[model samples]
Target: MARSDIRRSAPSPRGGKSSKEQPRGWRLFFRRLFVWGFSLALIGVLSLAVAVGLAAQSLPSYASLKASQNEQMIVVRARDGTQIVSLGPSYGKWLPTAQIPQVMKDAILSTEDRRYYSHIGIDPVGVARSFYVRYQQGKFRQGGSTITQQLARTVFLNNSRTFGRKVREAVLALALEWKFSKDQILELYLNKVYFGGGAYGIDSASRKFFGHPGSSLSLPEAAIIAGLVKAPSHYAPTADADAAVGRAQVVLGLMVENGKVSADQARGVDLKGIKFAQEGGQNSVRYFTDWALPQLDLLLGENTKPIEVWTTLDLKLQNSAASAIKNNVPAGTQGALVSMDRDGAVLAMIGGTDYVTSNYNRAVNAVRQPGSAWKLFVYLAALEAGYTPATEVVDEPVTIQGWSPHNSGGGFAGKIDVRTAFAYSKNTVAAQLGNEVGFSSVASMARRFGITTPISTVPSMVLGSNEVRVIDMTRAFAAVSARGKSIEPYGISKVTTTDGEVLYTHEARSSVQLVPENVANGITDLLQSAVSIGTGQAAQIGRPVAGKTGTTTSNKDGWFLGFSSGITTGVWMGRDDSRPVAGLQGGHAPARAFAAYMKVAVSGRPVERFQTDMVAPAFQISPDDEASFSGSPDEYYYVDENGNLVEPPADKTAARRPSDAPEDPAPGPDDANRGGLEAVDPPPAASEDFLNKATGKEKSDGTPPN
Candidate 1:
């Protein structure tokens, strides 16, 4: 009975075999099938191992991978060690794994690799899921890479979504897992991932997005940063904060699902408090940084290591300058301001009101007509030609080589002293002075005073017809405040490596003397009068100041170049397209900006007077005589070195007098106080004859007559 039951329960094998034997044969067939399948699976595994090894042979060596870790950032800092900007491929501070906030670590793991701790460099389940997703989508839509794999790819591989790269990435990821801990791999990933806005690594991304450090990141902020690893440009908080926060919400949900945070905690995250980085003040200093960056390359050639640049910029002053320009200047109009010490150490500079909108540095790159400000060199030339502040020159309209220059304010004062002409910015007098001194002499004088712009020998050059940069004009005026010393303006004070090795140091050097002390003093006295009582009155800052105001003919450019005993600053207001700024004049916006900036710039400094003593004329005039001569008739009056009226030598021809001829109609307000006239016909020979007759000798034009 037991044998029959066994035979009934047993399976059949072959045609001639019993039921029991058939069950044995069926078992044998199943076993053979299992062995063949197992053998094929083993061969496939061996083949995959061979393929991985072959891919690994073509990959970069471990030494190169280690060497790639040496990439550093360039940090531009102000004099006070405050960071201004960071520049380089890896533009961020390297943070250690311990320094990274735990929330940030969790956020990264949750979003990038949920099984990061449990997996050995790769996750089979994630790869299979990703493959299914890609197959359904008909494209490679997801990267099934672990954190270790990402670190390997970022350190030694390009970001190409290809099968070969994936193989190499997997091989290298295994190598990284063998060599480093999970924390080590995570730290490398955090320090090397790109977070958009040109930032690389967690520290830079933290500072860029939140204006803080990685160690201080909140959960939401960490989630936001972790979200950026998926697509940096698309999730950049600065460009699209909503997109960034939305992605961060996804990360937060993942974090909660992974048991890293509670659902209540995830819901409690507030993105409102996260202040996205702005391109305003953080980038306002970029104007100065841009100017100073090239100089660093010049100072330290071909340097690959990270360098710290210590600039002369006072961030406070820089901020003030930018604010003043933004608040004071008209919207469509652009402005530039540069401030420097008497020794040419640039203290503050703003190339444009908004650096992000336009990076063109007007202070250092723009070359526009300075108008009456160019008269400084003209007057300087006259002083060098033995003309003192008390010397008299006719202010009537004058023409040279077809360039007829008219005085600002239209009507002439009949005749005036050189000091009065300069103070009032009388264009005719400046042109006549240019003629008397010869245009070449004025051009040479400008070159000597640190104007690097090309100057033409045209007579209108005396009225600032020649274009110039604000920095050049500021440097020129600095020489005046420095008592005629030549100045070379510079921004960077020192440069050093992050490791504290000195790369470059700008030595504080004495300036070269360009103008005679007496001549400089005389010029300073004239310009000081301009600020105190003339067109530059708007630039007055309660304390003594010396500067000039200039407006181009069509109001295309306006300028205020002034200086105290300690600092010299120049301001320019104009349009980028060279179009006229409506109602813009040097005495208006430019002067106002200059005054506002100087008031803040000199707040803490003691009020110091200019060197008036050095400006004492070679000859002195009696107080009573100077007073009595103020209301004298409109006749040509000759003065000697002592500023006393003197008769011409009897042996020379008698001085000619201006006839009672009717004067030309007065100029309109638009014509008066403008930059000046353009090229016109040469003045009548009779005018020179009159001068020759008055001096009782041939006219001295500062050149040998042909």
Candidate 2:
């Protein structure tokens, strides 16, 4: 019994462990394996937390993100609601979530992420597919970022392909998803999204490209805007219209597959209608926009919020003007053209031959000599003193302050009426008229016509001897076109934000008549003769045109400025360095271009004839003028087809009066427009090929083809 008890009591367990005893079986192996896995998983979780913490530290806040972008971009639009240009970085008012078109949202979701609502900040299925694509292609070719993730990256991160950036993007995306609702995240994303051409935010882009708000977007328009997110520069509607349409079609197909719209519905959306609203816009428009940029501060008062400047620029007219200058301005020189309404609203401005070649906005900036074009004021001064276009004046040579001024053609009719003298561009008679009217009165007349440039009160001031901007010159003529009303040249008609809040609006003030009605009518009559029977005949376009030609000595500057079809336009030609062009004339290519541009600019507008009839104060003709009217008034001169100063043919002279003779006349030109040289009214030297662009026929020598 003692031996059995000892064996039982000391019964050493079996070689292997029992079920409840110290286990040495699969259970223990599994327990140890689970413990090791748990510890490793905990370590990995902590490591991921630390990495995410580091990434979150660098994330940018909304305020900081906004601060780095453009303070306020200026989006200029034409009067017809076409975008002229987009300048500065786009930072605009937030577009409400409701205003974001449903179609646009659907299009984005379909193209970017199908499971956007259900997916976490990081899309797992997308990640798997991305990984598969990487494995198959041996590199990361596809992205797995959800909408939330994209927003995080756009707001907080620079575009970098580093793995660390990817990790940070994921962490920030998670943080965004936790902090904001899906709609809020989407709103933020759309606002910060860059759609190119300095466009940011869907609303700004909509106004920029469509000339409307996002809330009014059509289906195809929405698809087009949505498609821009992938490759902004490559797919911007203005950049590559065809590519943008194709991408939009692809987006539509994706939308169809995603069930946002039926296949029929998507197909019904006209991709053909997805055109950019910036019609008639060209790179040359940079000149106008550049001119308008500085005025923003004046209009907006230091408010740098994104704004839409509604300008008076007519893009269609602008394009025509640009084409006219491009086709007419010859090599080795530059040209500028500006057109405005009768009330001084600037419609079009072309600064140079090519905006790419030079951005010097000669229209608004360049202050150059205006030559005989200043005769408008001289004649206006004479009219104010009761001189009519028909009033008689002796066309004899004159000397003023020891300066002798001669005709551009080097001759003067022995005795002629004032009309004959002015029509023939008789310089001697212009000097007589300037002396009769008083030089200060002539300068005052110019000032009254809105000429802000400094006009010398000296006797030479009777000739256009002041350096002036093309716009200012155009403005002076514009006042005349408005029947002697005071003019203030303005471009911006209204200023608004991207959300349609108007900041500034152009107000039409009371019209200030710079001249009496009769004087205005008399001056208009004089200008009419200048274009009809004078040097500016080429500027006529199947209608009554009234303008003047001005050429500085040595042809340093050539100008054709006038009014027709209720619009006042001006064209200037010269080298920027003020070097002489051998034979440039105000009536040459400049007149041709004015006609070319006006032909298109006046199309579809009602024909408005000039007010020629007026009550005038009768003035007695000087005894010498009365004496000169009788001695062979038939000895009138004209620029024949050969550009020579020749007397009319015997038969033509017998049949024609001085008003019927084609005369390229000039005003007093001793102190020629700020050119500091004697005014020389040479015949047009470049009319040979000027008509080919408009009439499609070569002109005969230097004669006008019309």
Candidate 3:
């Protein structure tokens, strides 16, 4: 049984050859196998040929990937369409061979490619020498990449540290040599290489680090630039001056030893006082640019391809603003200034004290309590609610819905005219007005004026408990200064391509009417008083000006927002962590900065006054009063000379206060210094109709009013 099973499993054959002895079938099978093998090999070869052809066709674009590279950068212009800064695409600017100094050429040749003219892309001798040196060091140390190989790495090859990437770089370099002449390759290489300090290419580096173009580079500067090829950031003149100079000397010596430069030339070069542009006055503006760039992108779209944007930045104004902030603000304090034209174009913006240390724009990014600066919106709401600029408001402490707001001082002023309250920044008057005009309606009015911050109907909101950004606040108030027209603030004006083709244009959009002309005029008048005699007195600019001053709790934030006939500016000073700044107030730093900036921003420009009708707003008054309820002292009519309530023919003879209510006390002092008087909750006053109906009706006991 075992033998039969073994025989059955051992072997099987179709023909009588025991499966291994069929010579003719085996021969035919071998022939067919040979033909199939030949066909498969041929197909593989053809497929490889097609792939190579396709790669060759695409190789021209990346051929000189290592030769030279240049990146195009867009630039931005200040107001008047003057360039303020440039944005780099690849940190490169193309320069011809003739435009580069011989010293620079010799220095680079000695350091990078000694036999570049003779090599066929790969320098085998150099590679072998580098390999030998590396082997001796027992580690991967030296790189033997030719200038073309560098170009390939910088342009076509990824920066992965792998043998595959090196092989690909070599292949790309060979293709580059096949497609371009040596001089063209050199030209491109010089134009594309990075030399550090935000500079790309020899032309930009030559100017940035050496303060000269490539053609004007001295021997020392040329050597320094050539040496930077090893480590651009480390050897950058701006970063490590001593190290860079030492490295530059090494490059000079190498050039001499390589016969690229004479020893005399090396000895004659001096690198002393070789300062970088970033180490000089140009650094002053970097902070401002860093903060402004992202904002431009956000407003103009991410693909603002042109590196240059035409902004309304006035350098003189910016300088003045910065100087004023530095001088007036505390040592650790941060500040921002935003100035706009009447059309709402942001003429200048200074976002922080140091852009390099911080890109956070305290002006546009930080939202803090607006404090008394918010009274402008409050007054606007009152005016829209039929209260005149001259309306009478009791400046005494009064509580509503369990909230009590005090003026700056703890004492309460009794009665005051609206204009005087606003001019003096009396908190009680504004809070009372907020109560009189429904809080929700006032909030709606603020929203219409473009106050983007979410506002709650709490009583404290009348005092700017809501947080607001300087830019948004300025824009909102600028609408008031612009005669009731609300418009968005923008920095960029237009963007264009290098060929002068306009890629985008930012037109000032249509403005919304936030308040009526008369209401705006009244508020503008109050703001003028603020600059003339109120907390914003420091902002007076020797011309008719209008402005408001704001100081938040604990002096944590201070602001002075103002406008002239032509330009409006908002200044803010505070700490980043929302801590208190000692003795800081709107009248101190922010006002001073605003004034300083305006002096320069409006220099040589006409001095214009804000336009107003000079007419007082009409106010709603008691029916028994012959005089209107204007806040003027003469207009208040409690004792109408006859010991009777002034009225528009009301039946007041028989009327009396409820027996349970407390007596209405006479108004007291109007000075802002006496602000807090322990605000007491009072019963809701009757509506005008309800009061008219109850007037002259005595209680059943016929007692005098409580």
Candidate that scores best on lDDT: 1
User: Which candidate would rank higher by TM-score, 1 or 2?
Assistant: 1
Candidate 2, position 701, lDDT:
51
Which should have the higher lDDT, number 1 or number 3? 1
Estimate candidate 3's alpha-carbon lDDT, on a 0 to 1 scale.
0.71
**Local accuracy by lDDT, each model:** 0.76, 0.74, 0.71
Q: What TM-score number comes out for model 3?
A: 0.77
**lDDT, candidate 3, 1-706, per-residue tens:** 9999999887556554453544578788998899999999999778755654554467745334433234546676777765556667434345687887888888888999998999978899989988898889976666888998887787767679899888777776776777678887787778777778777778878777766666677787888899998998899887888878989988988898888878887788778766665534433355456655666555556563435667767777767777877777777889888888888777777778766677677777788898999888788877755566566565666577898888887876655667778888898778777776656545555655555556666778888888887887888778888887765666667767654777667876655445556678888889998889888999987887899999999999999998985788888999989999898899888898888878777777787766656444333234234234223212211212111122212433223335554533322333111211111211233234322222323322454445
Q: Identify the superior model by lDDT, candidate 2 or candidate 3.
A: 2
Those runs of model 3 whose alpha carbons end farther than 4 Å from true positions after fitting are 1-56, 60-74, 80-92, 273-291, 295-306, 498-500, 614-706
Q: Which ten residues in a row have the lowest lDDT in candidate 2?
A: 676-685
**362 in model 1: Cα distance from truth in Å?**
2.1
List clashing residue pairs in candidate 2.
425-665, 425-666, 464-673, 465-673, 465-674
RMSD of each: 13.0, 14.9, 13.0
lDDT of 2 by residue, 1-706 (tens): 9998888777456874446567688989999999999999999889877766665565566556544453567778999988767677764556668888898889888988789889767899999999999999999887988988888777767888999998878888877766567877787777788887678878778877887877777889889988998899999887988898999999999999989999889878888765577655356788988887678787778785668899999988888999898887757989999899866688999999788778889988898999888888777766666566666555555677887787788876765654555555667666766766566556646654556556676666666677777887887788778777666777889999776899998887656545656677877887888888988888988887888888888899999998887899999999999999977888888999999999888877777778877573222234234223211213322222211123335564344325433332233553223221111111111232322321334332545446
